[model samples]
Target: MESAFSGHIYRQNGQGVTSILSRRVEGRLMWKQRIIGLHLRSKIDHSYLSQSQHADTKGKSVETALHSLVGHIEKANQYGDFTMVAFMDIEGAFNNVDPMADVEAL
Candidate 1:
């Protein structure tokens, strides 16, 4: 079955208008996504690659990141040490994933 999609433009705060890709994603693609999402979450939740609260499980979000940062800063300050933060630019990071490699990993 073919489903129609309605694209809309919306403005955020004072930002200029942005086009949003609206569509009814369903069928096999949706099911695959749901399954993969759950698997990814499970693998990430208990992995060392995930931070204390940055783990992708429930109740973890920006607030979690903020709390972790605050805790680190507090601990460092208490020890009379300086803390430095470095942010990485990961725009289009997904482009680095190779399709065949992804299939192999899956």
Candidate 2:
């Protein structure tokens, strides 16, 4: 079978070898990305960093963050305390980084 990503032909043994190989490649890529993400996130000083790529982190997505924020607001309202919120979009902030530099930094 021909691999769509690599454009290389792979031998099959009637056991979905192509599918297995593709999944293996994807797993390795995810692992590498996770390692790089962890290394970069370590430099952040904020204790509330909730990047979803980390294996141990939960409630790291925007939906979960918003849910937590709403929970906080509810708690503050119940206690008659002032609540403040600020949201910033840092999208594409790391899109310009060089892949080679990241590998070398690791």
Top-TM-score structure, candidate number = 1
Q: Backbone clashes in each candidate structure, one number apiece? A: 0, 0
**Model 1 TM-score (2 dp):** 0.51
Query: In candidate 1, what are the lDDT values of residues 42-88, reduced to their tens digit?
Result: 55426445446453557778787888899999999999999998866
Residues 18-58, model 2: lDDT tens digits: 66566778899778777877876565455554452333354
Off by over 4 Å in 1: 1-35, 42-55, 95-100
**Pairs that collide, model 1:** none
Quote each prediction's TM-score. Answer: 0.51, 0.42
C-alpha displacement of 85 in model 2, angstroms? 0.8
Q: lDDT of each prediction vs. the true structure?
A: 0.63, 0.67
